[model samples]
Target: MNRDLLGRHRSVLPDWLALYYDEPLEITHGEGRYVWDSEGNRYLDFFGGILTTLTAHALPEVTKAVGEQAGRIVHSSTLYLNRPMVELAERIAQLSGIPDARVFFTTSGTEANDTALLLATTYRRSNTVLAMRNSYHGRSFSSVGITGNRGWSPTSLSPLQTLYVHGGVRSRGPYAQLGDAEFVAACVEDLEDLLGHTRPPAALIAEPVQGVGGFTSPPDGLYAAFREVLDAHGILWISDEVQTGWGRTGDHFWGWQAHGRNGPPDMLTFAKGIGNGMSVGGVVARAEIMNCLNANSLSTFGGTQITMAAGLANLTHLLEHDLQGNARRVGGMLIERLRSAAAQVPQVREVRGRGLMIGIELTEPGTDEADPRAVSAVLEAARDAGLLIGKGGGHNTSALRIAPPLSLTVAEAEEGAAILERALRSLP
Candidate 1:
């Protein structure tokens, strides 16, 4: 059954779309932290469908909300008043940390980022954008142009002239050996130097934790320091929280808070988990920036009643249950468990991340060289052992991504960690 489905998928889907494992399993259904494949095997879903499943699969509240909203109205477009959309927007705006925030919804993170680009360029009246050295915003033409990760970037042509910045990866850069304070200072100097040689950029966009770049993060307060420099030049700071938002990081509700000393970003883009499997993405910005799109704009399917309903239900459940606290407590334990396991394996170069967003970078036994093949082998072995994880990195996808749903339990964490340990041990 899996083979036949794979053949059909390959024939219909675009070739650029990648799949996991040598023999990919078809996930038919899921409940809580587990999913069942077409072959009647169950696996702990640690990657949470690329971190799109923020809460859990088949969450009763979100499921009921989606069903009821669909029964009433699937979509009415942005042409009409959307109460559910308005409510969701209000909630997000208040939580955004940006005063007088305005929310515009989209169907995916790509669109959310594209919207941000349009706002920044038009508002600042400049096309020059600053991006991190190994950052990925989205796949759209504008978003992809600012994305610095070569593995994910498909084309060089772009409407925006993007300048790459430093300080995204803390462990593998020229300034890697520096202490946190010195590292931040060095990166700031680099940014100043880059600015000296280029035109005034409209905005600097970055991810707090680079998801596709193997969950790498700069030292805390790095963005805050950059914010000081950007503010002096009146450049916008757009935080791409596509993979780091909705309290997955454990320590904060938003990943940008790690650098919040200089205040929230000018604009923030988000997606991947808020809708709890429904299609929901959006940007939150101060009124001055969000309203810069002069003429008129609307995403036809953005904030459809169905998706808004799901987002509202999911958000309510997340907050009411204090899942952020759950993420903090559970994620702390899980990371320590993985760290202990990774310490025993020489191929495991590093284990990093906050909250539930963890990454295990693989390298050759006695060397710093990344081992992408070893990453693939462990991923395959983990699947065979009834666990589902993910792979990502700028170094040829050499890191294992382990972002489970926010509702992960202690027992489930232990189970997944043991499976992962066995898989890692199998590597050379």
Candidate 2:
């Protein structure tokens, strides 16, 4: 396909497509950190297509790798061993620091998560699964059941079947303030009491850092405490790094790494940036956990030929370009700038997150509705100023989720922040 900037043409969008919202822009092409439209206008992509385009669009090296692999072998079945598939799995193991960690690659994070659930249940012989409130695992039946967000309807969840724990409430935001110290400690104490009364959980899954819930990282020592509690109960601790892994978080290659002695989990799921822009995700299971692996038990096709090729290419790109290093630098800069901006503007309750995945939260000012107007004001204004962003949270409030490509330049970050600042000031 001769991919060029979108031609000047009006798209007759499908009427059958469900509308999540009334407005949807026609983005034409993307490269690096900017996207252009059919109208020949450019919008800086802070949203990075909800942070999926980690290496940017139409990246030459990644594309070339995909092309070459495609020409050679477009598909493969699990009945055979594929070179790229093995290589990709090896790369994941090395990057993840989990020795003897067996991987079950899949087409998406949700699939990997589902696979993790299967592994957890089969291995432990438990029925009840535990997850955080306001946390998003995926939209699939099992994942949605495991997901804690109330936005999901009963059609997708069995609230009676799954147990939802609090990720901790935001007294003022930054969640950093509520970190595992007091609030989390309270949760731990309460949870111990709850577990004492309620049924035992099969697995306790968590987003190493909350992704769709506004980039909320856990407070200090929180993970360690949670780990201890889960360990004592023989519950599997699964870290959902679908959004925070592959070096998006500064310093540690994994979000859990930054939690001091909190250490790793029994199982870890990674997606998003791992395959660069390609769609691929996998579950990294520790050896003790993998002892329960049953081949006939899992899906037919995982770690397929095409996806493995893309994943390898992505790993190569991260290593060669040092995107993780850039993520740290840019993420730190973004946090500093946002902290300063939020302080100056009381409307911004808190600015929290690590690396490029940052969130600018807008409190209700006085109500629980969260004043989406404040968030919309900033986002809409940014859009008018030629910047693209995203909104997420159970309340659908005004949280500006700024997760650009890890390759995002400081200049781009500065421009985006300025645009946001201008937008917030214009808010009434």
Best by TM-score: 1
Can you write out model 2's per-residue Cα lDDT over 58-112, one digit (the tens) per residue? 7777788889988898777766778888888887877676767887788788898
Q: Write the per-residue lDDT of candidate 1 for residues 129-182, one digit (tens) a residue.
A: 999988998899998899999999999999999999999999987999999999
Cα displacement (angstroms), candidate 1, residue 353, comes to: 0.5
TM-score of each: 0.99, 0.89
Model 2 Cα shift for residue 8 (angstroms): 18
Tell me the TM-score of model 2: 0.89
lDDT (C-alpha, whole model) for all candidates = 0.94, 0.75
Candidate 1: Cα lDDT at 236 = 97
Error of 2 at 62 (Å): 0.6
Off by over 4 Å in 2: 1-23, 153-156, 168-180, 260-262, 291-301, 366-368
